[model samples]
Target: MPTILCQLEAVLRFLSNDPGDPNMQACRDGLRQAIAALKRHIQAGSSR
Candidate 1:
């Protein structure tokens, strides 16, 4: 199964190699939103 953390890492690696890419910031923001959503889920689970 694909995880947000894994995808974020891949995005970071790709961006680092191609910093001039036009879609960089948007891609990064989307991945960050995914990660944030996952974090919210984790926090909720732990609070239970």
Candidate 2:
């Protein structure tokens, strides 16, 4: 199964075209933040 990080990455890539809608833009921004946070968590966990 794909990890949450992978799934979120896919979603972000799908939205890379910039749909020109304010709502979609905000959603994309949120996704980017989520992805970043998830990545940091994963990295921190892996160091243990």
Candidate 3:
């Protein structure tokens, strides 16, 4: 899981740093939501 998160974090960082296009706002929003959801899931798992 940690390894996966590390790799994923790199991608997330790239996405976050990107100056996204206005036309892709919906896709960016969806990615943000998905990242948040994954964070919540990770937090929940770690709390156990």
Best by TM-score: 2
Question: Each candidate's root-mean-square deviation in Å?
Answer: 3.2, 2.1, 2.7
lDDT for 24 in candidate 1 is 78
TM-score of each: 0.59, 0.81, 0.59
Predictions in order: lDDT: 0.72, 0.85, 0.70
lDDT of 3: 0.70
- As for candidate 2, its clashing pairs are none
Between prediction 1 and prediction 2, the one with superior TM-score is 2
Q: Give the TM-score of candidate 3.
A: 0.59
Off by over 4 Å in 3: 1-22
Q: After superposition, how far is residue 34 of candidate 2 from its true place, in Å?
A: 0.3
Residue 5 alpha-carbon offset, candidate 2, angstroms: 1.0
